[model samples]
Target: MPPDSDPTEYKVGRLIDKYDLDGLGQELEDRWLGRGYESQSLRSLADWFNKYILEEKFNRAGEPPMDGEIDNIYRLLTDDEVTSGMRLDAETALEEKDIDPENTRKEFVSHQSVYVYLTEHRGASKQHSSKDRIGSARDTIQRLQSRLIAVIENHLEQLRNAGELTIGEFTVLIDIQILCEDCGSSYSLTDLFDRGGCDCE
Candidate 1:
């Protein structure tokens, strides 16, 4: 899934539909039985569990969710919906500027909060500069977006090829990463996959 949606929602949904079932071994075999999903392998799922789920290396000890992390997720999901509103108001106050959507996208990507947003949502970084450019500035922004998407996609492919996660498990791992990055909270990898009470908190 892209970065604009709630990664938690995406991960949880996949867990319920795919990973939360019997015969996980069979399922893993089936995932690899066909060509593959995005070039992922069955071994990838095992590897992912071993690394992120079994190893539990997602966070530093004694960390808690931080401020503005929700805002970070919101920005990534809604293209900084809150920030865009605020900036539009500010732009109206300071100048006769019309709110350019492209400008807004660039601003969100450049914001310090973007790191938290990008790290978790796999494709959030791809949204950095995908607007149509009418002028040099817009064109420049598009170029940046193109380069960034390539890099992010490459990273995702590498993660997939590492043979450490299943498509389903990998999504959860990513969601955990994003949640941690956004909230600055450290969670055990086991705790993340645990369906006992893993609500958005």
Candidate 2:
């Protein structure tokens, strides 16, 4: 079976379903699976999703959830990587919408909190699978690597937009470097995969 959604991701992201953005998690996962994983980066995946899927959602709704005042505020409030200014802006946005910022902040949940929401509150099963290790390891590793890169890029953008992080206005560059525990040899993730894994193994 394909991996189910991670609760950690849900915690770190916007309240996906609440703002008429249902199916976003599934859409992201589905597109990433069908996309050319070897050539496409996670950032590319996100851009595609936003331009196509998210934009459609915005348009079809015919209006913002709160006359455009509550646009993405819930997400910004919850995103831990957002800069202080960004967080302030989200709170201000909420105030404009006549929502209690403190109450919303109090509602901020971590992954630990949502795990309880799922299994206990929602009566959902917690499922875990570890099978076909040899066959699936590469796919899992690549997916994880891509996810990390995209996550970093997102945080960087938040900081830059808030003027808290400066990088001379250049895009962040990331490369996955893997080191073999047994042989003390290092390889780029792409090169390692292309060579069918570590030579030491």
Candidate 3:
């Protein structure tokens, strides 16, 4: 019920009731005039409506961008700023969907994570391949070998005097064929006691 208020304000105020920006603006304008502030144009009022009030209610707080917010999701996907696979999904969802952007951003926070994609196009969970498993095993075995070597070096003198068939330097010179057939791999033993060939017999 502001003095000199627009008819649209009163009508819109009734439509939204307790949550009416039109009435709020009218109240403010009346108060400013009462305090003798100079009148401003409706253009500024419209700007305030679009920039502050409308933006706060519908656009900010990590809400997804409006439809057509993105010109091209592919461009964002290949952008240098986004570097991980998970981030790619999130960035795309934010660009194309109507979900809150904050949650979308969280989705890409862990790229290495495994989860169901819950989309109409793809389905099902899968385990890593045998080759991947083998690679991991090899890495673990190498780490174990390095640790054993450290232990041997720490007690090198004790081991050397034990006279109990120590692996010798020449053992490392064994032919690759012999090394593979006899020991399964060259990693298991040092050349200290290799018989030079796989045909030790």
Name the Cα RMSD for model 3: 30.6
TM-score of each predicted structure versus truth: 0.19, 0.31, 0.22
lDDT of 1 by residue, 133-167 (tens): 22334235434554565576567767778976445
Residue 163 in model 2: lDDT: 93
Preferred candidate (lDDT higher): 2 or 3? 2
Q: What TM-score number comes out for model 3?
A: 0.22
Q: What local lDDT does model 1 show for residue 135?
A: 30
CA shift of 21, model 2, Å? 16
For model 2 the local lDDT of residue 146 reads 45
Give the Cα lDDT of each candidate. 0.34, 0.49, 0.35
lDDT of 1: 0.34
Best by TM-score: 2
